[model samples]
Target: MGIMEILMIIIPTTLLWAAPLIFTALGGTFSERSGVVNIGLEGLMVIGAFTAIVFNLTFVDVFGAWTPWVSLLAAMAVGALFSLIHAVASITFRANQTVSGVAINLLAAGVALFLVKYIYGKGQTDIIQRGFSKIDIPILSDIPIIGPLFFSNTYYTSFVAIFFAVVAWYVIYKTKFGLRLRAVGEHPMAADTMGINVTKMRYYGVLISGALGGIGGGVYAQAISSDFGHATISGQGFMALAAMIFGKWHPLGAMGAAIFFGFAQSLSIIGSSLPFLENIPNVYLLIAPYVLTIIALTGFIGRADAPKASGVPYIKGSR
Candidate 1:
């Protein structure tokens, strides 16, 4: 293919792969910014994927073209509800936050698998008839080089993901709730003294994470996989966590990191098609994204600092 054609293909594919990561990483940003260590993002994503596939399969006939979108809502609701287990354990009962998150991951996987078997009598669900499709933006897709590379043949979810990243940045840095969320995460005792309701803020943070994470999973299922399976999520959630840390807990930063990772992921799948990369071994291509993730997390981008009170449960009057 010519360079322009290749660019068009690669850029759109990267966005497709990046959209879910953006959502998940943004979710991580919210949870971490509020001082809760959300190790269960992977589990939350699995729950989302499963719920989305099942709902889409069941309702595609009823909802028609809107099935996938409606399924995302179902995933979001279920994800939020499932995350309450973590919130109650970590915030209400003062359990170790890490342990609570891990439990959520384990519980979500087991519950999802069990429900899948019980509902389908099989390991994976059948593909839905109405998954997301790429669309060329009306006038924008016709605007020369930039249009073809960015707007042509793009999933709507990709734009939504980018839009939400900007919204996330504003919500975290410019809003009153954002200020209180940061305050609670940085110093729960101080926030509590200021009548910030530290517990309530943390709960809100975790719930938001769950909702976004669920959307991430749903997007992956409907736009990429078209079905749910044991490997549906794979390690996308951990990769998103890596993006959050690599971005230094900033929303726009995480979105940029996710796009980078998405590019790496797209290369792994499309490398053989490119003349320069075709000579490289397939194993290296497959492992590039993971290697890059480790590099990003291991100080390749300088020191990344977590919130001061992150992972620490707050007792009402404790010092």
Candidate 2:
């Protein structure tokens, strides 16, 4: 393909890959902003991916094209319910947040694999026949360079992810709920003194993390993996966490960071097909995203400011 053709291919692929990251990073934002450290995003994503794939396989015919979207809802619901474990352990019982999150990750992996073996008698679930396919936006896709690069032959989920990023930014910074959520994270005692239920805000934050993280997993399975297996989720959740921190925990910043990482991932996948990158070794390409993640965390952790009370369990009536 020519240069223009290559750009067209790479740009949309990057966005498609970035969609899941955006969703998961946004989930992290919600949780951390509300004084919760949700390291279990990975587990929630696995559950979401497994649940969505199972639902899609079971109800593909009945729901037709709507099956994937409905399956997304199923993922979100299960994700939220599973996140309650983390919430209760961290918020209700005041257990160590990191330990609770780690436990969640281990539990999700075990449960998903157990269900897979029980249901399929194998290590992986059956693939769905139909998934979210590429769609060219009407009128917009016809625009000259921008249209061909972005609007044409793109996954609808990518646009939805972008839209939600904007919505997340608005909800996190512009609304009353956002103010209270931030307050609870920064100074829960002060928030409680003002009659804001710190526990409730923290719960909402963690639940939002689960819901969005699940949706991210669902989208990834449908758009890329098309099946659920032990390796289906892999390290994308951690990558999302990295993106959240790299972006300074802001929604739009996370979106940008996700897109950058997604581009790196896409490069790894497509490097062999490109003219200049074709000469680079495949191994380096494969490890690029993870290496970038390490660099980003190490380079930015000192400068990036987390929520003041993140990972700190709240104690009522303790001044």
Best by TM-score: 1
Best by lDDT: 2
Model 2 regions lying over 4 Å from their true place: 282-302
126-207 per-residue lDDT for model 1 (tens digits): 9889988999988999998889999999999999999999999999999999999999999999999888999999999999
Q: Let me know the TM-score candidate 1 reaches against the reference structure.
A: 0.96
Q: How many backbone clashes does candidate 1 have?
A: 0
What is the number of backbone collisions in each predicted candidate, taken in the order shown?
0, 0
Q: Please give the lDDT score for candidate 1.
A: 0.90
How does each model score on TM-score? Answer: 0.96, 0.96
| Candidate 2 lDDT by residue in tens digits, 189-256 | 99999999999999999999999999999999999999999999999998898889888889998999
